[model samples]
Target: MPPVSQAPNPTPLYPWGVPPSPPEKSRVGLMAGIIGGVFLLIVALLATLVLVGKKIDSSYPPAESTLTAPGTLLDGHYKLAKDDSPTLGPSLEKSWRLSWDAKAVHGVVVAYHPSGGDRGELIVTGMYGRFRNTGEVRSRVLAGNGSRHTEVKVIVAPMDVTPSGSRIRVSCEEVTRSWADGKALSYPVCAWADGNTWARVAYMTVYTARSLDLESAARITLQIRSEMVKPIK
Candidate 1:
């Protein structure tokens, strides 16, 4: 008796002409796609950085400027005097100034009571970057060779407020002193920084007085800070 032969398995075939994809090749393709996506993301980030840099350059005002003349003040009560001659530091360079490399600006403004006689004084300086040791720095400047009255440092109120949605900080210094005529004097100086701008204002007596109007001095300083935040036209 002969045994029946087992039938051989037939080759598999699909209705359409299709080829099987290699698993390794598929994996390599997926990896390539991921790398491409990452490269695109990096390029987008770099473009965003360039845009931000442009915005800052266009929006921020020039840190270096001559003193806001007494007449330019919003109140319009103060005016520069011919003989007073407020000192303006070196003229601003034509080149662009960045916040990190910008230098400080120094200038002066003098005023009179309009009715008669001297009406106190206002001085200003602006700069880029943060301010520190303000009290000490101002103290040294006040004790200049020309200051007739000895400036005695006193208490100052703490202020932390931003003007025009800008970063700002304020400080005050009160001192008692005597004039050439031996009249008791009150000097309250207020200082503040708006972003890269730093300014100081002091209430001086045209005539001998007992106490300085600190509130007025502080008010003026805050006003200056607000202006500093605005872009130059």
Candidate 2:
């Protein structure tokens, strides 16, 4: 006869069954971390490559002691006003100095006041250096100027023969124009590389209203180089 049977503990129905399992962790944060790490690694690798390239470029042989800018060129028509100046200024930023990386560099700013004193003050800036590859240096030097202020025409033509009728290792010319006092002025930039020496020349004159001749500027550069770069005996 026994007491009434105790009701069995009621079990939870489907909706209230055992406690739900813990939620799975999200992988978004992990994935993002991995991607960031990879990107940083790639950037570091690129930086290392650039450093190696710069080191190789600077590993060229020592420059000859005699390689320098002369005091005078073109029969004293151009006189050296400054030698090895601390900086080349904005004009150089548009030309060789931007891309010029060499073992040794010599810079000179020449002043030209014609006998008649009618042409105003003409300046020639020359940059000489020692490098490994003539073509590479020449190309870099020319590319530095790019298309800035070059509205007339973009000329990067090869100069097979110089004024002396002798073949040059590598030569090129770039022409650009600018306005001064409501007058258009021209700048003829030239680059020449030979042996282990590289040179860049630029013509600037605010007094003259006429455009400068490219061929003549290139010839003058050659003359300047000839006088400056002497045999390393």
True-structure RMSD, every candidate: 10.5, 9.4
lDDT of 2 by residue, 1-233 (tens): 88898999876677666787898767998899999999999999999999998887767655553445566666777666555344653354344444545544555555655444445444544444566666776776566555443444445554433555656643556554545555644556677776456655655554332554666666767776777678666
lDDT of 1 by residue, 106-200 (tens): 43333433334645554443333333344443343333312443444344433332234433445556665555686655566666644344445
lDDT of each: 0.48, 0.59
Give the least accurate 10-residue stretch of model 2, judged by summed lDDT: 89-98
**Segments in model 2 whose C-alpha atoms lie over 4 Å from true places:** 1-62, 65-67, 82-84, 89-101, 106-111, 115-129, 146-167, 205-213, 231-233
For each candidate, what TM-score against the reference?
A: 0.44, 0.52
Off by over 4 Å in 1: 1-67, 70-74, 82-119, 123-167, 206-216, 226-230
In model 2, what lDDT does residue 168 have? 66
- The best candidate by lDDT is 2
